[model samples]
Each structure stands twice: as structure tokens, then as C-alpha cells.
Target chain A: MNQQVLIQAHQRIQPFIHNTPVLTSRLLDEIAGAHVYFKCENFQKMGAFKMRGASNAILSLTQEERQKGVVTHSSGNFAQAVALAANQLGVKSYIVMPKNAPQVKKDAVRAYGGEIIESESTPIDREEMADKIRIETGATFLHPSNQDEVIYGNATAAMELLQEHPDLDYLMAPVGGGGLIAGTALAAHYFGNNCKVIGGEPSQADDAFRSLQSGKIEFNDSVNTVADGLRTNLGDRNFPIIQQHVERIILVDEDEIIQAMKLIWERLKIIIEPSCAVPFAALIKERDNFKNKNIGIILSGGNVDVKNLPF
Target chain B: MNQQVLIQAHQRIQPFIHNTPVLTSRLLDEIAGAHVYFKCENFQKMGAFKMRGASNAILSLTQEERQKGVVTHSSGNFAQAVALAANQLGVKSYIVMPKNAPQVKKDAVRAYGGEIIESESTPIDREEMADKIRIETGATFLHPSNQDEVIYGNATAAMELLQEHPDLDYLMAPVGGGGLIAGTALAAHYFGNNCKVIGGEPSQADDAFRSLQSGKIEFNDSVNTVADGLRTNLGDRNFPIIQQHVERIILVDEDEIIQAMKLIWERLKIIIEPSCAVPFAALIKERDNFKNKNIGIILSGGNVDVKNLPF
Candidate 1:
């Protein structure tokens, strides 16, 4: 939206989030032939940038809404973020997850004080179940990535990065539901010094990339990608912002994603999930276009199942 | 060693080292029943605290010695630390690693611009090879953990930790060749508010603990431990420091180490090597002794081969 709304969202959610560190690696820089600054939201509270959005959404609610509680149907980082944020604000959270969702994800949500409502492993089932819970309890239904408050809240991370390094030439992030990239674009537009925002999307799940080309929301018919987090399609609330501000969307193959993920873990010595590596993969693939430029990559999250590493 | 030496070491190596972040996890603190502060050396320049000691050793060298270069025999963190530090300081480094050392370690040393010399897979063979190289090239042979300069270099970690939180009730580190623990003890003695230093040694490789009781430098005749980094015995230079200042040594088993390592990986959302988990393992094992106290644990390194994770 506007700079004022972004600032207000940050002010409201700052107490509940971590101003995560920006990390750099010489080897990584040398490999990509650019000065790469990683805005490590992997180290954020609940280990993702989603925490900022979750906190802001809950904090924006009225006293009556807060009393009723919040509801979200997510089997990823956003689920944990909302649960933890609500718990911190002393508000109840109802998380509707798929019946076949990873046990680790379910455990993490419960650990953060979320009440689980399991549905059949389908998008329709998840949405209907969450809607039922919302109707029953009169709870606020918060979309993981498509809400206005969430997008403005996510903008704070890039805002903080801009605050530290105002002259960054390019800001890059993976396009998963188009939320993070949209927020990053807004932050760069309002705060950066001649900065452009770029999105990295997996070729297997290329809905966001297609959405940009068609100037309309698109969906993947059959998603098949290793980056489990990037399979979701774009939504109306954030798609317009992305279309207006995002410079380009780079599509990378699964192999490149795995290579990028391994490099971060080995050189940066940080655990980042497959979705987090997508931007770096794109950077590597398009090194000539960005050679020697100052780049900022949003490492989206670090919640990987160590027992099932692809590398 | 005195506080002056520790301060001097930090000043000398400050340009070449990182003031790594001190991380806190509510879940980890709850598990330990103490307010635990993790001095994350895993995020250091070489992904370990060995960088501090290695850089200090190189920086402390005479002009002629610097020209002649430095050498060490290590198959672990110190090898890469020495290689990278020497490269950073514009000094040549010769690393004599055992033939059976992991190929990934060799690649890391070479990537850091160190000349590698392969020796037979034995302690004696590795030392003889390194000593021969030292004689041939007239290079200073810097022992991985036994030398005074290295110990003072290592002390800078605890010094930095104390600089951030000087009121810590205790400081904990894994006992490998006694260098880190010994340096930690010296730092706590001089800089902390009555902070007692504690050592975490694997019960399988309990040389340091036994040496304290026997009043002599002891050896682990059959070191059978999952903590490959802590298999080395206490050395002459650091044994006296450990004996004089360390409050107590905690010995934990293999299962406990794995559990502690998993907890840190899961809750702290950081990738720590098995060796780095030793101090936390000890903390979790001895929660009663540290309950409600402010404790600092030195996360030794994060160089585990992700291909073969224990958990």
C-alpha cells in the first residue's frame, strides 16, 4: 500500500518479531560474481518472515475479533508463525492442517499452542474446515500470504535491510503465492535508492511467473517440484502489487535449486529449506546480468526436515 | 595467561575474525533449566572458533616467521581455520592431514589456499609429516590446540561473550585437547562476574576429566566416542589452566549428545556439528547444577557432513 501503512505495521509487530541478521559469505559472493547480502529471515522468530505478517494481522484486529480468536489453514512456515504470534498476544489460534501433513509440521504448530483441526488432504477440504471453524467460533480468517496486513507486515524485513544498506542495487526473493516478492517490491519502492525487486520461481510450479506474463492470476494444473513451499499460486490481494513493482521473474530448474541450497549450507553454514534457495539459484543462473551488482536475497525460512535431506 | 594477553589477542585478530552473535533459545533454556546463551562460533569466518586461535597464532608470528610461513597437522576445523586465516593475512599455510581424513575437509583446505600434504592415517605419522615439512620449509609448526598463542586466541571467544554479558554465572565448552575449555576458564576468571568455567567431555573420551583427578596429563587409550572432535587428549600447555581454574567437568554419553544436538537443531533452528553439541549435552545432562543461572555455551563449529547426519 503506502509507506505509512508499512511503518505502522512494523511498529505494531516489532515487539513480536526478530530484526533478523543480514549474513554474507565471501565464497558465495565469488561464486555468483556479485556482492550478495542475505537478509536472513531464516533466523526470524518462528524461523520465517511469516512471523511479521502473522503478528501484524493479529495485532490489527479489533478487541472483539481478538476475543473471538484467529484461524488459518497452512501446513508450512505460516502455520507456525500464526500459532506462535497468537500465543504471544494471548489470543487463541485454530490451525487447520491436512491429515497427511508432515508430523514435524503438526508438532511444531501444536508446540506453539495452536489447536489443530485436521481435514482430508485436499485444498477444498482444508478451506471448508477452516471456514466451518471460523463460523462456529466467530474467529478472524487470516490468509497465509494474500491479506493486505500480512503483505505490509512482510515489507518490514526489506525495510530493515534498506535501513542498513540503503544503496542496494537489487532485492531478490522467491515467488511463493507472490506475497514476499510483493512486499519486498513495495519496501524497495518506498525506501530504497534506485533498487529493483526480482522474483525467482521454480519452472515446475510456474504459476506466479505466468501470472506476470498474462497480467492476471494463474494456477499450475499439476505442480511437481522439490521446493514444496513454492507450489502455491498467486492471489488477488498481492498480485496487482507484484505486477506493478516486480521487474522480472526468473525460473530455475530443480537441480539448480538443490545446488544453491547445498552451497548455502556448506559455505554460509546455515540450514535453509529448498524454497529459501530459489532466489540464489536464479542469481547463479543469471549471473551475467547481475555480475558485480550489489544484491540482497531474502532467505525465506529454515524449517527443514534434517532426516530427509535431498543433498 | 592473563587478561592482558586475551585482550591483546582479540585486538590482534579482530581484523581477521568475527564477533559472532550470542543466540538465545527459550526452548533450549527450558530444557537446560537455565538461561543459556550460545556464543555461535559456527557463524565465524571459518565456521569455528579455531579461526580465533589460528589467526592469533599467525598474527603473533615474527616478520621472518611470517615470511617463512606456518604449518599444522589437523584433519578437522583447525586445518580449515589455519588455511583461511593464513590466506586472509597473506601468509602461506601448509596442512598435513591424515590420508583417511574426509575428502570434503581436504577440498575446504585447498579452497582456502592451503597446500595440503597427505600423511599416513595415524597421529604419529601426521605429526612426523608436519615436522618434516616444517624443517624443510623452515615454517613455524603451529599445533592445533596445545600452543599458548592459540589458547589466547581461543580465549577471545569467551572474552567477546563476556563483553556482551559479563554477568554470566557460568561458561561451558567442550574439552577436546583442553585448549577451548582452558581458554574459557582464563577468560571467565578475569572478565566474568564470578563466572565459573565448566568442561563437557564425552564419557567415552574422558581424558581431561581423568587428568584433573590424577593430577597429570592423561590419555584416552581407546577413545570410542561419537564426538570425533573431542577424541584428542589434554595437552601440556592447557592442562595446567584447566586444572587451576575450571570448576568441574561434565561427562555425557552418546545418546545424550545426539538428543541435545537434535534439540538445538530443532528449536534453535541452527545447524551445529556433533562436537558443538557436547557442551549443550552436558548442560542438559546436568540441569540441576545450572538451573535458573545465566550460562554461556560455546557452539564449537558447524562443519558436519550433511550427507551422513547422525539424527
Candidate 2:
């Protein structure tokens, strides 16, 4: 995908999404010795940046496909995103979920008007369930983070950030399913004026980090980080873009992630998910590299359970 | 005192304080049965609306007064507000705190460049200590929410909300020492098109509510609410304004406050103090009155201790 594709994705989803605000804190700036701008995607619809990709993918469907509906498999924010986006667009959405998924998540999907088809608690099972629904209903299947349109859609968040603050020295986003960071890397490449792109990943789930070092796709053995959203490995659609455009990926430990998450909550006074905090944690882990630089971090989402906070 | 006062206050504090973003949530609006706009003073400097008044009060001082710095007696956000306001203006601030004040608060005040003067943990002792410091250092003693300039400063938060959403049928703020509610009432009177101002008071600290009924100031026998920022009684200066301009006071209990606070944290995805939740609780308690009408609530602060959350 090119810059034109990113621009078109933004235009398509403009009415369906919020151009989330950029927040700053002097106390946090002093703590990190850098001027930091946080693009708060936590305030986005359904409380995550996943909404952008979901909205873009759904909006790009043919009129016939739209009438038939959309299908996706997700045990997380994507389920809510696709459901809500489809509902907003007046299209039907079917979400394939693992039976063991949290009741709250299931309730959220339903609340967003998504029809859930329960699958066994496995990736292969979820995909099979989604495929069955697509075939039965003549629906369009939307990959959460592994398609050109989804990655192009996610790029708009960073594009808006750059439009507002074009002089940022570094743009950072967590390395989740690679959609967000890949989009962010492309955003910095096309829209930014020599701004470098950095990826923040949990050490326990360091697929993106290893993939960049080895120059190919990599898999994780233990998907055991508190940043549950970032456990997924990079996809073929986004991995090549990340390799070519991403400046570097930094790995942060679980404790460091929790500590950084607490600081963002306390100092920024905004609720952000643990996955969202991974990049900010990485910046803090090796702050010497960012000292006095103008930095921007895309806070991926704010869907954490306050009752069960890691802190 | 008038529209001119609020206009000047906004201009004076514009450089020092943030014109904090007004946030909205479709979920909250649907739940509350009204179109609601949240004037988020929780995102204001010092993480509370107190900064608006503190900055206005500090800026309104004479050149001579500003030179000697400012003084206040508080065990909470006001102390930090005065400290930071003073520091921002490159002036020294002396805060009279109770000896038993939280160490974290004391640290926050000091970090904001405020000098601490410890006093016995009583209203009488704190006032006496503040008076002594004022006499000794010639610093202007700023009341937390009692004086005219401070109240006018507090009014600017609502003035801003009204400017952004002028068609709001009602503007609500939590009643504490009466500064915020009094100022809000005045703002609605001057800037709104017949917009009514509502005050939310804790049943445990129902002074403002009772004062309105009595047509004079009243005091609560007990101030046993989790909303610690709202325990103080109305002062003579702000009570008259409240009686004259405020439409009514709504009493919310502790449980309602905590429930609304949780909903805001979970749905709005922002950190707000318990005191900030009182007005929303009152709105939800009496949603029928606000059904389909445009409502605005000033979120008071975001200074709650996360570890000690009621929910």
C-alpha cells in the first residue's frame, strides 16, 4: 500500500472514528527528560485503535458484501471494534469467539450488536469458525491486523499525530499483531519529516523484535506477557513493511510494563491498557536514547479492568 | 462577580492553565438519558479545576503581592494548585498544612516548589498558622474557595464549558467550599441562554443544600464522605452568590458517588476523583429531569489515590 491508500482509508473512516486528542504532561516530560505527545486512542470508539482498522476494512466492502455482512474472529478489542463499526455502518457483523473468553468480552460484543459464534479456545478453531460463517452467510471476512486495508487504516492515527506535530523526532507504538506499528512506521515514512519509527514489544512476546533482527517472520514459544493484546505474532501482510520502515524494536520486561503503565495512569491521568504501555515502558527503560528529544507515543487503547489493575 | 470578571479570568489564566478538552461518551449519554458534555477539569493542571481559580487568584494579585508570593491552607489539591501556580509565575508559595497530612501530598506540594509550614491538624490551627505566615512573609493569603477572586477564577471552568456548548440546558458542579458551584452559577447567569446551574453535594456534607433552603449559610454536623475534597462548608462570600444564582442543590450518597465514579472510569476511560463523580451521580439519580435535555458537568479533579478506590 502507498501513501494514497493511507489517505483514502482515513477519508473513508473519518465519519466513523474520532481523531483522538494528543495529550502532554510536564511532570512526565521531566521524568523522562523528553517532550512527549501521547495520541490517546484509548478514547476511540470501543476504547482502542482497533476501531480504525475495523472501520476502514468494513467501509471498503462492496455494496453486496456489505449487505451480506462482515465476519471476524477475535477474543479481544477487535470483536468489539468490528461489531460496533458494522453497527454504526448499519451492516450486520458476526464475531467468532473462544468459549473460554471472558464473560465481559462476550457481553461487550453483544452490546455492540455482534452475533457471536463460539469456537474452541484455539486460533485454528477460531479461524475455522469464522470461515464457516463467511461461507454460510456470504459475508466478507475482515482480518484484525493482517490485511492491506486494515494496516492502511491504522496508519491514519499516526498520520493525524504527524499532521498536528510534524516535528516529532521519534514516533512510537507497541508491536502487537504488527498492524499498528507497521502502519505507524509507514506514517512516519510518508508523512513525517525525517521522524524515526520505534516499536515497543514485551520481552515475553518478542516475535516482532526477533523478526526484525532475523529479517523474517518469527514465532513466540510462551505468549506469557501481561500485555495480553500483544501476544499475537506478526503477519505476512505487515511484517515486510515493518522490516523496511521500522527503525528499531525495544523489548521491555513485565515488571517494567506494569510500572510504566502506573506512571501513565498517574501522570497522564488517562486510563490506558497494558499493551498500550509497552512502548512507553521501553522508552523509560532506555531513556538515555530519548533524552530531550521530542517523542510521540500512540497509546493503543484503554480497555483495562480497573478492578484487576496490575499495579 | 459579573460576565466581565469571568472573561478577564479566562484571559488571565489562559497561559497558565489548560482549556481542558470537553469529553463526551455515547454510552454515558444513553445511560443518563441526555446529551451530556463533560468539561474535564480532571485533565487540568494539578489534575483538578482548582488550578483555574488558583491561577486566576495568583494572577489577580497586585505586583507587590505577587512579589511576596501566595499562601493557602489545605491538605489536598488546592495546596498543589497554589504551589504550582506560584511556581509557574516564578513566585514562592507557602502552604500551611496539617502535621498529619499525607506524606505524598506533602511531597507533591514541595515538588511544585511550595514551602511547607506544618500546623496542628485542625481548622483553627491551620488558619492560625496561615495567618501567621501571611503576617511574617507578607504573602497574600488565598482562601481555598472562599474569596471573590478565587470564585471568579473557578467560574472560568464553567465559562469555558458554556462557550463550547452554549446550548446546554443545565450546568452541574460538585459543591464543596462553594467556590466552584458559586462561580458556575454566575457563569450560567451571564453566559448561558437561561441555562440553570445545579450543585451536587454529599448527603454527609449537606451544608450547601441546607443553606439554599434556609436562605443563609448552613454547616454540616458531620463530614464523613469518601469525597474528601468536598468536606468544607460554604464561606460567607460564595454562599450569597449560590443562594442568588444557583437553581438548586442535589444530594448524592456515598454509594451513588462510587458507582458513578466507576462508570466514568470504565466508560469514559479517564481518571477522575470521587468528588468529581458526585454531580454525575446526582444527574443519574434524577435522569428523568434531564431526559433529552443538553447537560454539562464539570469533572472536578483526577487526584484520587488509585490504590484506595472505593469500587
The top-ranked prediction according to lDDT is 2
Please provide, for model 2 over B1-311, each residue's C-alpha lDDT reduced to its tens digit, 9 standing for 90 to 100.
Answer: 45787899889999999989999999999999999999999899989999988999999988898999889999999999999999999988999999999999999999999999999998999999999999998999999999988899999889899889989999999999999999899899999989999999999999989988988888988999999999999999999899889889999999999999999999999999999999999999999999999999999999978777898
Q: Write the per-residue lDDT of candidate 1 for residues B53-137, one digit (tens) a residue.
A: 9999999999999999999999999999999999998899999998888888999999999999999988899999999999999
Interface RMSD of 2: 0.7
Local lDDT at B19 for model 2: 87
* Runs in model 1 lying further than 4 Å from the true structure: none
TM-score of chain B of each: 0.99, 0.99
How does chain A of every candidate compare to the true chain A by TM-score? Answer: 0.99, 0.99
Give the per-residue lDDT of model 2 (tens digit) for A1-311.
56888888999999999999999998889878899999999999999999999999999998988999999999899999999999999999999999999999999999999999999998999999999999999999999899988998899999999999999999999998999999999999999999999999999999999998898899997889999999998999999999999999999999999999989998888999999999899898889999999999999999988999887
Task: Give the runs in model 2 whose Cα sits over 4 Å from its true position.
Answer: none
